[model samples]
Target: MNNPTKEEIGRILKSSKRIAVVGLSDQPHRTSYMVSKAMQDAGYEVIPVNPTIDEALGVKAVASLKDIKEPVDIVNVFRRSEFLPEVAEEFLEIDAPVFWAQQGIYHEEAKRLIEENDKVAIMDLCIKVAHAMTKTH
Candidate 1:
């Protein structure tokens, strides 16, 4: 997989304002929750995209990416690697510019699909870490 440069990651973080977090957990202790909370605290709009949850991080959750009415800058995924292809398919249907899979989650096919569409695909990376490193927030 091609990794984004620190500058590229910083550019994305600086340009993006709204993020749709797929598989975001409602529990505060969960990594998804913690990460999303951090992003929210950094002034990014974190939209929870999980069918199983009603809401997360004080924001009303949507069942899927397609359910989001507002434009999404990044589709931040927290699902396992095995589920990436499926999520990638759904991502293609949306207008988001970036597809991001959190740390420990990487799939070549998903990356191919997203990049094939001329969209940014970032895998096996933590958005928060990238954000902190770039100090984009």
Candidate 2:
């Protein structure tokens, strides 16, 4: 799969303000919660997009990407690789510019769809790590 260069990824992190975290959990022990909490600490607005949860990190959660009425800069996914294609399909219906699948999650079809639509497709990478690396100068 084609991945963004460090510079390009850095730019994406720097420019993005709002993140729609699909599959984010309300439980603090979950990796999704920890990483998303870190993003919020770093000044990015983390919008939880999970049908099961009511809220996470103080922000009210939306049932899905379609439920988020405001603009989203990045759609950061926490689901498994097998579920990516479906998320990618839903992502296409949104106005977001970036499709990011968290670490250990990657799907060729999902990546292709996102890139084919002219949006940034990032997979098998940790957004928190990217943000930290980029801020290190």
Candidate 3:
């Protein structure tokens, strides 16, 4: 689904503590960098997943989700919609609970694939915004 209900969003945010950020950039100007930084500052453990970068925001970067050894609560994707299918495949491999596409990023196929596997798929929403909203509760 393109838009998740408030309860579902809250549940995901409340349950998730460790986030894997795919396509995260080291640059401060990038949205991924800013969002992940905010998440880290919020006390969530943020793991950086980016092949091109060695690290992001002082966290070690893994090339892919498959490389992550620890349990990942949320897979926050910063990649474009066109790349989500590949990201979705990785999510399935890792059996991630939540697959979140950042603001302005959405793919029906990816969403369908994730939801079909009974995982929560959040699209076109910012993780920082969701987390901030959930914190108010």
Candidate No. with top lDDT: 1
After TM-score superposition, what is the CA distance of residue 65 in candidate 1 from its true location, in Å?
0.4
* Residue-by-residue lDDT tens digits, candidate 2, 34-125: 99999999999999999998999999999999999999999999999999999999999999999999999999988998899999999999
Task: Please give the TM-score that candidate 1 achieves against the real structure.
Answer: 0.98
Q: Which digits, one per residue and each the tens of the lDDT, describe model 1 over residues 5-44?
A: 9999999999999999999999989999999999999999
Q: How well does candidate 3 match the true structure in TM-score terms?
A: 0.95
In candidate 1, which residue pairs get closer than 3 Å at backbone N, Cα or C atoms, i.e. clash? none
TM-scores vs. true structure, each candidate: 0.98, 0.97, 0.95
Clashing pairs in 2: none
Model 3, which residues run further than 4 Å from truth? none
For TM-score, the strongest prediction is 1
List the candidates ranked by TM-score, beginning with the highest: 1, 2, 3
Cα displacement (Å) at residue 84, model 3: 0.6
Give the Cα lDDT of each candidate: 0.95, 0.94, 0.90
**Which has the higher lDDT value, candidate number 1 or candidate number 2?**
1
Candidate 1 deviant stretches above 4 angstroms? none
